[model samples]
Target: MNRITTAIAVLVLSTAAGCGTSRSATGGAREGNGTVTGIITLADEVGPKTGDFCAGLDVRVTPTGAPEEALGNRTVRVSRGRCSYQIANLPSGGEQLAFTVKPSPAWQCGNGATPTLAPEPQALQLKDYQTETRDFRVSCTAPSAETSTSTSTP
Candidate 1:
């Protein structure tokens, strides 16, 4: 009985010691999933616009060079003014990701102008356990008079 108790104690101590060591001590650092978060803002030629200008818009994050059924694609809708979004559980290790904003087809600026995302789609490199921010600015500009004018014949 004494020998058995001694063996059990040794086993428990070894397990505890193993658990306390840092991941780097055993080998290289452990790879972990990463996250992407950011805010979406609505703007016009004058300045930033408030209220529901951002509502119903979507922000999407997709892994580049990934398979068709890859797991990293994510999309979130803007819920309010200065909307924020987060895409988690993305596989890390310096993977490239594409971030884009999608505006509703029926949505338009307060001045009856079309809105567009500035800087276009963004590309980012994600690292292990890292959080990346990619903010989006949706700018609305009224069409020029020439573009909106109607032609008349005598």
Candidate 2:
């Protein structure tokens, strides 16, 4: 069922991406512009979900040129521990799009104690009718020492 849901999401995104170019912040398309879809994979050297707390993530993406004006600061969301996150309908032929993985204490990307995105805001070029993927690793950090006890000792 989980795989089905994720697959559905990809389908929807692909459909949206196929319809043509993305509209500006004002909801208008630019001539000769294209669309781009981005994916953030959190599977690099990471453990399985294993019934861990699945936490959704918010991603912030901004089109390089005229960022705030054209594309604005758009935030995308994905299911908790979801391997693939699709950010679609971005304006192409504009500027290099920058992607930032929002931070969450519950999810750690690597061995870092702070649990932050390694490179941060992964960037890419936009193209029409195509999906671009960025590989990343994320893991849920251990709880505090107080919470590590498996049983209460009276």
Candidate 3:
């Protein structure tokens, strides 16, 4: 029964995703811009060490060649060590777009230690009428002694 219910829920979501391409009175879709869903995970090397804190990441998306007045909001915050970013109401013909990931201020090992961070920003282009997913690995350095040492006594 649970499996059946899960399957039904998935079907509904997929169906809605396929058909939800119109503007509405609510804040979902205002145009035919399709949705993009994905999970942002900690780089393999940066995980457990950094506690796999997803909230420590920042994301932003912007359409290229957009008029200054046409600027729109595309920033998303990671929740529960993951993120599901969706850029809606995007103009269909917009050729290029920008995606950026900025690690949060707390993305550290603590104790004034600066965790190694990704060297460069990850960017992605936009494709209309498509669902897209992209994964990025941020480079990071090992935590300093002060931050890496455990306080528990043996």
**Highest lDDT scorer:** 1
Write one digit per residue (lDDT tens) for candidate 3, span 63-114. 5443232223343546555544555554444456565556666554433444
Model 1, span 1-154: residue lDDT tens: 9999999999999999998974532143323477788777766452334455444666655556532322343545446556677777665787666655676554567776777877676677778778888777777877779778797999
Tens-digit per-residue lDDT, 70-144, candidate 2: 343333445455534555566566456665666444554454334445455556666665455565555335456
Model 3 residue 153 CA deviation in Å: 31
lDDT score, candidate 3, position 39: 53
**lDDT winner, 1 or 2:** 1
Instruction: Please give the distance, in angstroms, between residue 59's alpha carbon in candidate 3 and its true position after superposition.
Output: 1.0
Rank candidates by TM-score, best first. Answer: 1, 2, 3
Each candidate: how many clashes? Answer: 0, 4, 3
List the candidate 2 regions with Cα displacement exceeding 4 Å: 1-25, 30-56, 65-81, 108-112, 139-154
